[model samples]
Target: MGSEIAVRVNGTLPAFSDFGSDNERAGEVESNPAMKVNTSCSLIIHENGKPTKHILVDTGNGVCNSVKQACNDLLAGRCVIDAILLTHSHPDRIDDLSLIVKEFDNVHVYCTQNCWNDVIKKFPDLQSIQHTSVEAGKTFEIDSVRITPVSVQHSNDALGSVAYVIESEGRKIIFGWDVLTFQNPNDPLLKGADLFFIDTFTYNPHPETNHLSVLQAYDLLKIWNPKEAFFINYSGFADFKNAENPYARVPKKPMTSDELAAQVMSDTIPWGYGWNERVKVASHGMVWRSTKQIEFMSPQFSEDMVKLFTEQNYVFSIKKGKKALEVTAETDIKNISYEFIKYDVESEGRRIAATTKGGFLAKPLQMLLEIDDSSDPAIVKIKVGGGTNIKMIDQDVSYQKDIHVKRVHADRLRDFLMKLTS
Candidate 1:
């Protein structure tokens, strides 16, 4: 196995001056472009292994010098940046591109063809750097990681914006910035991500066609259900110090940092709900490492309770929780026309004792299936069955047919109990 993948946040732009302002006191953080240069740029992703590779995303003003200094001080120059990926052609997002090209040799710059043209036209003097054009939906590999671009709506329609999905060793991550909306809701490329960073500019819902509001971001998280999500792209309106009407209903004071020797400024406006545990507001200098573990629920099921019931598997459907579970099965395994009886549940040890009222031709049956809820994201312990109480409807007799299964069903029950707190 190679080393682990790491993503580091270099800076975050301060929110706009009027962000989260009420009829009362207006917020204080200025929306000047000069201040944005200090906050809004840089992500250094180190894909570990024998041949470790470092990839940089976005180059806001001063990012090149900061990252260059970090390489020297942090790793003794062992990890050198190999490539730079642009999210858009906006000046705040690419102010330090020329400096990066001048400082680092043979660094390939990748972006949409439209963004590439915009960059050249805006900065004609900086043509020496190698420019590589990438199209949406196309994928490119660097070391063990595969990256794909998907189109996103933004204020700068002429330059456009693209969100990237990076996959490596069964792990997936997404990076989206300055995004307004997605072209498709069910884009397979955007689903089942392990971790993602998205644009969250305003706390309240906004009718603007450009930036995403906190409410819109919450909707997207409910759909994707990533293991973790971070909100970026702040305006001055994001001032937590003056926030009187927070979207999450709870107010949080500014977070201080020991490294910076100052209060760590935050732009996050959290919204509490079931998915709140998996998402947070982002801060500068934050880092994320990929674990490559399937401990969290996918689009369908994980360790705890099975949350999905698909048409493909019609024989049985399940609804599970911390202390209660419901399993519904069809009377006939092969036919969808017959009436189905719901399984009544009672807990015993690790198993749930389930009994079904006899169907038209079937006799009442009792089944036992084990469930283990000791870990996060738990799994089902055994297949659905309590064959002892089950009898044929026509014969009115009991039988010992096992509800067969192959894996450790307990592994499927990770966090149903914990979800109660969520």
Candidate 2:
């Protein structure tokens, strides 16, 4: 087992539509990639600094598409969700539940009984999948991880919302959201966690809403005394202008990103815990990693595939001025020490990116930009083609969409294919 648990914040907004409500916020959401939200949050258990098991929490309305991209791009088709845990039946949280089940092969889902009933009514077609009805205070095991679902007080006790407490290898994590407060106030399990994810709503409490205000959550957070805390599911601006509370300070209508940061910072203070970093506002794609994490090496080609490229025996003519490979005559392809080209390909509904790291990373991996003499007419391209099992790497790629080649040391691939073959 690896020593680190990587918490990837897949999504953070209450709903994507929250930003669309106002034109200015909508513009910012479009302009700033970080401000854009999706349905999110997943836990990746790492072994030897590589991802082994993935547990997804809350598949929001658009999370499946994002998860699909992550599965292909970041994970290089290596990781799949071992299990999915649902917190409630809110549209923003469970709308994409069916999509996620279909995306992955053979996955199990666990949701509280109260939530499960609503889930079935919402998607009757999903009743037959591998699913389990869980109850609050029940503890279950997945691999080496222990998960306990503790019921929390949301607006509806009828829907049966609960927060998950995950423990593994002496590391405890609380993934709490859409909460009013813990139903059992004095539950010993709520305190002293290594990673804490709590809900932060408007600056002031609104009785009609299910979520806890920043102040209410703050009071509970101080007692928990976690090493690191992140506030997710936030929609905090524009409500502070009308604070009726005597203790609360006032802020006006326009809240810049800077002011929001400062406002959030003031509330998230490390009160005598001797910690430097207090609570953080979790953003999309944010990762909270263990101190022992090593740089992940993305999946490279298989050894069998690498052996296929040796047919060309190191030949290329590189034009440094134009940053392209040059070949007109069959004579232009010459025997050289190496032909270094940084390239990307998006084909067959999958993305592959190759880059030169340090030096000589490609030769051993055999991500070759070479010509094949085995075919009758001969084929000239990167070591990728139809029916060839290709693997993706999280290395340098996609400088622009489609295929972006930083530098190629051979004939322009299209010219070589058409001129020689035709």
Candidate 3:
């Protein structure tokens, strides 16, 4: 059975100071300084829902609470901490290990010899917990998961930080946090990963700290070429609110194509988005299942399917047309949080239509999906809106039916339609 990874928490310590102050920019303080508990991630690995292997990568302050909740929510049981894996002895990463172990029994803690000693020094009570020393380039098995520790440079060399390559069955994940620089670019552990969770403490091109910057992560992704990647450990100065956009922040000054390419490589502006199509910023309670087992079906005319889309707080519908499937939805176009372009609008139209016989103006967002039984992928064109604002003379406009275009992935809609209409 293949292992599935789920994020229990998602965050890192403040890059600047404990106060989370950043005079450098405005509106950047939303990066979890007040809520450090949301920054650190605790992951649970499971297979077949029988033997769940709970491997915690880090235990930042207040993460134990998040993990406990996640276990109950995801596994449908109480927290079962099978093992605790430490990337380093940084206080932010290992502060809550003692508290977490208190809630469980027979928990094994894995880390480097130096890190283990430091952990013991910091949390003397953790001495009772079983310890397994790991060395760089050596593989260790904790339950069914095989992990290879690879040393990486961080601010504090005394603790001796190391990254990990966790493999189960044929799937593999590279977890590298608190990373400043890699010892070897071609390290065997750094190659061939299904998913990579790395550090992104700063968003600047030239970061003063030893931690990895967003731009640096882009370069690493180009070299490693993982199937998917996620940026963790964001700082206050990093772009937090506008992470959904193609570009986190557009450069104020213009430069040559070569210079522009050097800075931003990804299509989306956020640290994770533009570097690779699959890469995204890791968040709390994010669950990833390797294979789609088709657990449930969304048949046509099912109210459950509409409820699923309605729960998103957006207006949308899936209609089974004779020739094809039709999907219509609307989202507020005023929100600039997401900056993206999809397939350069093949053709668009906008006209004021009648909402009723009284002639109230109404605008609508529409997309058409053509089903192709052939091997080739279908050309699905989706329009969030007609790229125009809805204008009605009446301010109250009670009769006007609102239609602000909502962008939906055509492929996903197509797949659901195939299953529902099948």
Number of clashes recorded per candidate? 40, 4, 14
Q: Evaluated with TM-score, which candidate comes out highest? A: 2
* lDDT (tens digit, per residue) of candidate 3 on 1-422: 55555544434443335323433322333443444463455556656654376777778776777676666666568468777888888777777788888877788888999999999988888887789999988898876779899888887654578888888767788888788888886875687688788876666543445678766887887788787777766553433434556655553232221222233334434645334345555543455544531111121245224311221123445444444333344332211111121111111211211111121354332222232323322222222332222233233321112222122333344444445434
Query: What TM-score fits each model?
Result: 0.56, 0.64, 0.64
Which residue pairs show backbone clashes in model 2? 325-410, 326-410, 326-411, 327-411
Candidate 1 residue 35 Cα shift, in angstroms, is: 8.6
- Total clashing pairs in model 3: 14
Shift in Å, residue 60, candidate 1: 1.5
Off by over 4 Å in 2: 17-20, 23-27, 30-39, 72-76, 237-247, 252-258, 268-276, 292-422
User: Per-residue alpha-carbon lDDT of model 1 for 1-422, expressed as tens digits?
Assistant: 55566666666553233334451212222333322333333333434433356677787665776676557533446546677888888776778888777787787888998888888887897676787888888899776668888888886554557888888757788888678887785797887888888776555544363677655776887788788777776552433533665454322322212111111112222334435446655555455666432112122454443532211122333454435345554321222221114343334334444555555764445544444455533334333333335332223322222222213333333233334224
Question: Which regions of candidate 1 are displaced past 4 Å?
Answer: 14-51, 73-76, 207-209, 236-274, 292-422
Instruction: Give me the candidate number with maximum lDDT.
Output: 2
lDDT of 1: 0.55
Pitting candidate 1 against candidate 2, the one with the higher lDDT is 2
Model 1 residue 378 lDDT? 39
lDDT against the true structure, per candidate, is: 0.55, 0.60, 0.55
